[model samples]
Target: MFPAEQTLQLRALDPEDNRIETSAGIFVVEGSAFDEGLEAVAIDSWGTSSCALDAYSAGDVADLGDGETFTLNADGTYIWQGDDDQISGRAQRFFFTATIPPDFTLSNYDQVLLDEKNSEGMAKAFFNTLTVVIPATIILILIAAFAAYALAWMKFPGRALLVATVVGLLVVPLQLALIPLLTFHVGAMELLTSVMGTVDEDSKLTSVNWFGNWFGMSEGEKIAGKGYFGAWLAHTGFGLPLAIYLLRHYMVGLPRDIIENASVDGATEFQIFTKIILPLSFPALASFAIFQFLWTWNDLLVALVFLIDSSGNTTVMTKQIVELLGTRGGDWEILATSAFVSIAVPLLVFFMMQKYLVRGLLAGSVK
Candidate 1:
C-alpha cells in the first residue's frame, strides 16, 4: 500500500461547477488488479508523476469520505463534465496507488525453463553450468585427495617445504592469475589442436573416439576445441590449492595407528589411502566438494574466459543472468526469476553439506 505521504493527490480541480467546463477531467474509484484496496488516481498538470494517462471520460465524480480517495480506471481514463468539455493538455501525467499481495506462482519457472527463444532462459545455461561444475568438482577432488594424502603420509625429501608451498598458495589472490591463465589456455589450446590435427590418419589414438567426442568433435575432425574441458582444467588448477590444504590437515589428524596397522598387514599404499584415509576424511572432502561446486557453478569470469566462446552455445547460468540484465532491464519478473534459478543449486548444496562444512571447520581447529 502506498503511504499517505506518497499517495496521489488531487492538486487542482478546474471549474468545480456545473458550467460548460472546458478541459474537465473527472477521476473515478476502481479496484486495482494487484490487490484489494481503494487506489487513489489523479492527473498532474506538471507531468512529473511517473504514471501516464491515456484518455478521459465523462461521469459523476465519486464522493470522498474521511479516509477514502478516487482511483483512475485501469486504462487511465475517466469521464469529465460534459460532451462539450475536452481534456487536452501537455502535462497530463497520471498517478495511481497500487497495492501488491504476497503471493507466488510456478509460472515464472515454467516460462524460464520452456521459453527457448528467451536468450535469458536458464534451461540451457543451467545444464551448461552443470557440465562445468560436476566434472571439475569430481576431477579436482580426486586429484587433490591424492596430493593431500601424499603430503600427509609420504616420506620424501623437502616434504615440509612442499607442504609450506601448498599452504602458501592459499594466500595467492586468484585475480592475479586470471589474465595469465586465460592467455595460457588460449595459446595452449591452439597448440594442442594443431598437434592433434597433425596426428596420422591411421593412428591408433584416432581409433579411440573419446578424445574427439570430449572436445565436441568427431574422430575425423581430430581437433580439440574450446569447451567444458578447458573450464574444468582451469577450475581444477584454482581449486587444487585449497582442496589439498584442507584435506592434508584433516588426513594428518587421522589415527596414525590405523594407517600403520594397514601397512603392517601388507596393504599397498593405494589400498591404505583408498580403504582407510579416504573414508576417515569424508568430512573434509565433502566440505571441499561443496566449496568447489558452488564456486564453479556460480563463476562468470572463469566461464567467460575458458568455457564460453564466440558461439555462446555453452553459456553458464551466471553469464545467462548477466545477459538478462541487459536485454530485460526493466522486467523485474524475468530478472528475479533467473537470479533465483542460478542460486538454487548453491543453496541446495549448502543445505545438504552443512554438517560436513561445520565438521571441516572444527576438525583441525581444536588440539
Candidate 2:
C-alpha cells in the first residue's frame, strides 16, 4: 500500500494444483515488501498459497500472466518487465502476490501440534495446570491426614461437631463459597499488607499483593484472590471436606491395637501420624490424591475465579482449551488433536491410580 493506488496481486498453486487466491504478505523486515502470503508459510509454516510464477530456467523465461515477466538479477533484485513500476529498490512496505506451488497439499502433525503462538498446543495452560494441581494435592492430603487422625482417635472439645460440619459440607455446593472466600482472601491480604508493608505515595502496599488495582484497571479491581497460591488454597478448601471425611473413614478401619500401642509407648501425635499411621494409609492417601489431582487438573470455574488474572499467566488447561475452541472453531482436525492432547494427562493418572480408586471410594462402606 506504499504506492497508495497500485496494488500487489498474488496467487498460489498447491502441490495438488489447488489454485489459491486469498493470500497476501505484509513485509515488516528489510528484505522485501512484496510478500505477505509468500512468507506466512516462512514465518509460521501456514502455507496459505504457492505462487504460480516462481519457476524459471537459467536462460528461459516463465510467463507471468498479464504480459509480465520477472528477472532475478545477480544482486538479488527482482526486476520485472511489466506495465507497472519496478519494485527493485523500494524501502517501504508493500503487498505482493505470486502463484508458486505450495510446499504442502495437506498438513501433517507439525502444523497442528506446533506453532509460533502455540494456539493449538496449549503448552502454557498445561504447565500452569500442573503448577496448580500438584501442590494443591499435596497440601490437601497432608492437612486431611492429620485432621482425619485427630477426628478418628483423639477426643477434643466440639470434635463431634467438627465431624458433623465436615459431613454437612460434603453436600454443600462449592459455588456458594466462591464470593465469600474471595472476599476473605482479599481481606486477609489487606490486613497482612497493612501490618507487614508500608504504604507508598501512590497508596499501593509494598507487600506481595493479593487483589488490588495494581494494573490501574479500576479503583475497585481485585487481584489478591486470583493467583497460583490462591488456586492452591481454593482447591484445597473445596477438596478438604471429602479428603478429611474419606481419610477418617479409612483411618478408623486401621487396627485399634496399633494406635493404642503407639500411644502407650509414649508416641506423640505427630510421631504416630508419621511413623505408624502414614505408612498404613498409603492407599487412602493416593486415592484422595488421585481425586484431588483429577479435579484440580480439569477444573475451570474455580480456576477462573481463583487462578486466572487479566494477564492470563495462571490460565489452566480447561480455560486454554476453551479459548482454542472459540478461536479455531473451524479447524476440526486441530480441534481433535487438541482434545487428545488435553485428555492425555488425566487418562494417564487414572490408569496409574486405578488400584487405589476402589479402596478410596469404598473406604467406609462396610464399616
Candidate 3:
C-alpha cells in the first residue's frame, strides 16, 4: 500500500550479460505498477557508463522484448547510477516502494517465539532479584530495628562504639572486598561439599569446575569464578551492612514513650518489636525496598561476575540486552522493546510500594 516515485531522463544501456545496465545518471519511475517478485534491473546514461540496481531478484530482470518496455516485478526500487548523473550532471536519486508478496507471510512465528522467550528470561531475572531482595529486606529490617532499639534505649554498654563501627563500615568500598569474599565463598563451598562427602578424593572440586558436573552445564556455560549460591550470598553480604545502618537510623528516631508504655503493659522487648515497631516502620521499609530493588534489578557487573554462563542459561536481562546489541544492533525496534522490557518490572515495583512510602505513616506513633 506504500506509494513512491522516481523521475529520470532516458539514458544509454550497456550490454553486460542479461542484466540491464544504466549509465552514470539518475532515472525516476512514477507509476502504479510495482511488483516485489521482479528480478535484476539496471539503469544507464546516454554514455556507456552504467550502474545496476542494488536489489534484484531472479525473476525481476526477465526479457520483455526489445528492452524499451521492461516490466518491474517488485515494489521496492534500487539505484543503479551514482550521485552524479552522467547525462544531466546533477544529483540523481531512485525511489521505489517495497512490494509485499501476495503469498508471503508477514507474520514471522519463530521471531515471535524468540521475543517471548526473551521476555520470559527477563521475568526470570526479576524473580531472581525478588528472591534476593525480599529475604534481605526482612532480615535487614529486623536486625536494624533491634540494633536501633538497643542503641536508643536498652542502656547497653559500648552502644556508642557499636553504632560508630556500623557508621564507619558504611564508607568502606565494596570493591575492596571482592577477591577475599570470592576466595572465602569458594573455600566454604568446598568445605561443605567435603564434609557432606559429595566429592571423592581423586575428583577435586575446583571453583571453575564446581558447577560444571553438578549442574550439567558446559564449559562455556559455566559460572566459572562464582556459582549461583555464591552470587546470592554475595548480594546478601553486600546489602546487609548498609541495610542495617539505614534501618537503624530510622528505628532509633522512634519515640521512647511508646516503648515505656508497652513495658508498663508487661510487654517484652520482642513483643514490642513484633507488635509495634515493625508496623510503624513500614515507610522506611518500603523506602529501602525501592532502593535495593532498583540497585539489584539494574545490576550488571555483579551478575556478570557471578551468574552468567557461556550457554546463557543463567544469564540475566542486562547481559541479554548487551548480547542483543551485539547481534541485533541494527534493529532499533527490537532494541527499544528489549530495553523497555528490562525496566518494566522495577517500575512496577516502585509504583506498587509508593503508597507505603507516605511521610506521615510514623507521625502519630512518634514525637
Candidate 4:
C-alpha cells in the first residue's frame, strides 16, 4: 500500500528465508484464503525513501532501522479462524518502513462553526460574547469619562480621597469581588421584584410594566435574571477603576488656560466639557475602550458568575471553549478550530485599534 495502487503479492521465500535478515518489516495476512490469491511479497527498499506503516496496531511496531530503511520479524504467525470464538485472535500485522503522511482539511473548522450539533455551534457564543462586551465597554466608557472628568477638574470635599479610593480599588484582585457582587446582584433583583410585587394592578408603576419594559423583557418575563444588563454593570464596576485613572490623568494634562478662557467666554462647564475636553480626550477613551472591549470579550470568570443562566442560553466564547475542552478534549481538530474561532475576534479588534492603543498609552505616560 506504500504506492497506494500496488497489488499485494505472496511468494515462497528462498531457502535462505530461515536466516535472520535486515529488511523493511513483514506482513502477516491471516484470512483463510489470503495465501490462495497472493503471490510473492517483495518490499522494494533499496532506494532512499520514507514510508508509513499505516497498518501497525498499537504494539506491533518494534524499532526503526537506519536511515531510509527498517526491519521486521521475518517469522509470522497465521491463525486459522474456525469459529466465532477465534475472531478476537485474528489480526493482520504489517510493518512498513514509512512515515505518516500529513492530512490537512477544513472540516474541523466547518464542524465547529457550521454544525449546530457541535455544542450549539460557536456562533451563539460569539454573539453572546459580543453582546456582553460591547455594551459593557460602552457603559464603562460613558460612566468613566464623566467620573474621570469630574475627578480631574471638579473640586469638592473628599475629592483626593475619592481618587485614592479609585486607585486603591485597582489593586484589589477581581476574585474578591466575585461572590460579593453576585450576592449583591441577586439581592438587588430580589428587592426590586419584592417592591414590584407590592404594587397593585391599578398602581401607576404597574400600568405599563415599566421595570420589565425598561429591561426589554417580554410578556411574563421577570426583571430579575442573568442577562446582558447585569453583565454590563459587573464589567463596568471591574473596569471603572482603571478607566477613571487613565482618563483622569490624561484630562488633567489639558491646558488649564483653555478651560479658564472658555469659562471667561460664558461657556458653561458642561459645554466646555462636551465641546472641548471630550474631543480632546478621545485618545484616552479609545485606548480604554479597546482594553475594556478585549478584556470583557475574553473574560470567562465574570461571565460564568454573572451572565450564564441555569438554562445555558448566554454562554460566551471563553466558556464555550472551556466546554469544548471538557466534552471533546480528545478531539484535537475540534479543539483547535474552536480555539481559533474564539481568539479571531480579539485579534481582529487589537490589530484594527492598535494605533489608538499605542497613542493612548504614550499620550498618558508622556504628558
User: Roughly what TM-score does model 4 have, to 2 decimal places?
Assistant: 0.69
Model 3 lDDT tens row, 163-268: 7887787887778877788887777766654443335453343333554456554322322455567676666667766777766777777777898899999999
Best by lDDT: 1
Cα lDDT of model 4 by residue, 77-159, tens digit: 22211222212232323332222234577887877767677647477888888899989999999999999989999889999
All candidates: TM-score: 0.66, 0.63, 0.60, 0.69
Each model's RMSD to truth, in Å? 9.5, 12.8, 10.8, 11.1
Ranking of candidates on TM-score, top first: 4, 1, 2, 3
Q: CA lDDT of 173 in candidate 4?
A: 96
Candidate 1 residue lDDT tens string, 1-367: 2222222423223323322333333432222322334343332221224443222221223323432223344433433322222222221223443333435678767767676666444677888989999999999999999999999999999999999999899988888887788777767765665444344533313433454446565444533345787889989998899899888988989989999999999999999999999988998999899989988887988887777877778988888877765542544566678888778889998999999889987997877
Tell me the RMSD of model 2 versus the true structure.
12.8
In order, candidate lDDTs are 0.67, 0.65, 0.55, 0.67
Cα lDDT tens digits for candidate 2, 134-153: 99999999999999999998
Stretches off by above 4 angstroms in model 3 are 1-120, 123-126, 201-225, 328-333, 360-367
Question: Where is model 3 poorest over a 10-residue stretch in terms of lDDT?
Answer: 40-49
